[model samples]
Target: MTLIGENGHAADTLTGSGFDFGEEPNPYGAAGFPLDRRYSHSLYHDADAEPHTGTGSMENLGFGAQFPGHPPFRASESFGIAHPEPFIPEIPQAVPDSQARLSVGSVYRPSLGARGLPDLVPDPNYVQASTYVQRAHLYSLRCAAEEKCLASTAYAAETTDYDVRVLLRFPQRVKNQGTADFLPSQPRHSWQWHSCHQRYHSMAEFSHYDLLDVTSGRRVAEGHKASFCLEDTTCDFGHLKRYACTAHTQGLSPGCYDTYNADIDCQWIDITDVPPGNYILKVQVNPKYLVLESDFTNNVVRCHIHYTGRFVSASNCRISQS
Candidate 1:
């Protein structure tokens, strides 16, 4: 295939021949073809020329084009645009809600372990347990102080911007916690599941999981309200009046949500009660969990919640402790 130039001229016809970026001087116009003016670069091909390589490309035969096979090409290990392979399949961002989220197969071992052991072995340190999408929708709600309920009482509907912060606890060790104490400088490579991920070469397959301020599409505040609810729910964040936990993961515990090991984690977000005006509730996914694809169920999970009302505390609600 030959690359046609912007001048309505065929720069060079392929006779198993190569490309020439130089101007087409005295270019030939076919019988009914329009005359070729000096070829101007189109947006797609404007930036110099991409190096082309095929069975007959100059680079294949030792000539570099401006791009991959650029001409005057010093085979310098210098900089140049990197092209993607011809057919990298597109991974869908969203999968059906009810679809099976896991790869189907037995945990097969390829090689025999110390005398052909075939039975599944559990890691004594496996810590038995375990654990633990979407452009979130935003909503705005208004409030005014009806009466001073008390210090611990719900804030009367006095209108103020409700700020929100989302936190995702991971199953991995948390710092200063009694069990599974994690150090601040702990290397990411230390976790078993994480190590398994490295073994599979599937890290890039996941989406960039991060905490997002869904309304503003920004980072969430560390420990304060950053968004407001749009639905007509009393805006409260207090532990007693505002929140409740899901008995979903291993009965109780805190960590990012996961589909395996049966342990549960928690996500906490603070919502504000603003003075009656349209506002956007931002539920930013904690950045730590945003890109994880290991847990497929979470991939299709909508993170759906009906803003029942405002809660007072930034801390997650507990069911087991209750």
Candidate 2:
């Protein structure tokens, strides 16, 4: 008996009697097809139908029934039908929100003989003095995401060489801060000497402070080091006390501030020679932009200062838009 497929193509010629279509297991639908779950039986023969001369086998007829639009199947040739690759939807990853907000807290001139001040050993090339202006700096950082901000320094030694560098194995990314807008027109090489030096000594990262002449817009003196310490008061000024070096090895936690006391070394800009005049004390955090932040605009604070040849004072100190 000759059987025609649903597509009106001669599917197979059967030569057997009492062939039971209902009892035969469906090989094409054993795993199931992409188009439908039910198998097609359009090419199957009735159990009571008489047999006829056939050139193809039942396996060959099964292909045409499995896929209606597919080409005809042959008994002698090996079947190698191509199928469309499986569909896989792509998923997007979430980005982290890391913000490092730095601001200047207070600006003042310590007594000529403050205990915590560093001794100025006079150098023939440079004039030194005992009087300087100290500014309390604050760093308020937060990681809104679930990940923690982590970083470390590692030292590696080879047979003939050695190297030391900061490593950001976790989410924390920190770097040395500088004067972001101290001298905009001047080349970095010309201003490199004024950069904080104490940061180079410690394996940890630090921020920088600058005393800028608001009138001339020139940086007169700058603090060489801004320590990352714990504050007795919160960033929001809930209490008032002092900051001390505490977490020397770990990064600042999210929603926290690393406050450095104004009495710390390199916390003052020598004003012994600076003429008495109005000035702006600018403090910036993460000035190098080595670490990623959600917002950079809030990294600076400015304080207006009134100076006399005999005494110096700061007023109107607040977070600046610039």
Candidate 3:
């Protein structure tokens, strides 16, 4: 499906959903400094689009390494996160997980359909792919030039394995929290650097997407968009953006959102094989239930999709239980 924005260009096609909106005044924040300060620095560093997947054991360490004890936290420009403590807490033991309510926003960006044909990537190559925001204009031009590449190349109608690409803006929202939003300590966790993304990304996979048959309820296609950088890009309840996923901190304050837009590489499912018809597009945040939440019922969202031989349309989007 070709989605032409009001300006005729694809809707925010080449832009990764990022937070540069400047800090929204946080009334709940510390007096002098607005960026809420609770945790210490992150122990690991991400370099060249790769972050440390190291989950250091928090077994023996200072009180700060355990629950209730917070340490110094800082975000690095070149690196990613810096934490003072040696040990970091686990996901289940995370204080915020108890109160933090995670919600998956409806699909945003034009990728809601099949506008991501060019966003498709073969396996193995996806590991080094970069978000469109980090790529050059030439890449978009290349995709535009190859608009017909699908018909000529691997994605012929006879091809059943080609990925039906779609650029997506899956917004991860922090609707509520115990005392704060979903704040995971940087130390126990790890951040990887994406040189192409030119930023820090959570070492964990945050959200997973799948397309299921409406008739049989069978999964036909799926994709895993990384949880992405922790930031408070937009807010709702409190109307104040708190956590920016910046230095000395990382999280999504209540009413705040963390966006993983369609511009990121490989943000679509393999739909070429999916028979043209109606299906349920399902997206779930915290699919593993790794991060404890107050309400798991609201963690899933589904939409009705109609796919003809060549194009697809989405409707009846609703938030539901997985």
**Candidate number achieving the greatest lDDT relative to the actual structure:** 3
TM-score of each: 0.19, 0.35, 0.46
Candidate 2 per-residue lDDT, tens place, 17-117, comes to: 22234654322211121111110111121334333333334333243323222244445444566544333221111110111111221111121222121
Candidate 3 C-alpha lDDT tens digits along 1-322: 0122331232233222233324532111111111111221111011222321444324423234434345446677678877564434432112111122222211122211211111100111121122121122223423322322111333345534323333322332333432335655245246665555455556355666777989899987776655446666666664677666543466666545565544444344545445678878776666664444434455566777777756666666666656
How accurate locally is residue 72 in candidate 2, as Cα lDDT from 0 to 100? 47
Candidate 3, run of 10 with poorest lDDT = 116-125
Candidate 3 to truth, TM: 0.46
Model 3, clash count?
23
Q: Residue 78 in model 3: shift from native, Å? A: 66
| Model 1 steric clash total | 59
Q: Which segments of candidate 2 are over 4 A away from where they belong?
A: 1-205, 226-248
C-alpha lDDT values of all predictions: 0.20, 0.31, 0.43
Question: Which model, 1 or 2, shows the larger lDDT?
Answer: 2
Per residue, candidate 1 scores C-alpha lDDT tens digits across 1-322 of 0121321122222111232326542111222121111111110112332332332323322346323322222333456645443332211111111221222111111111211111111111121122110111122211111111111122336523442222222222111101111111112343123231122111211111122343564533222111111011121133111211211111111221112121221122222221222222222211122121111111111121223233111122111100
Error of 2 at 33 (Å): 34
Poorest 10 consecutive residues by lDDT, candidate 1: 173-182
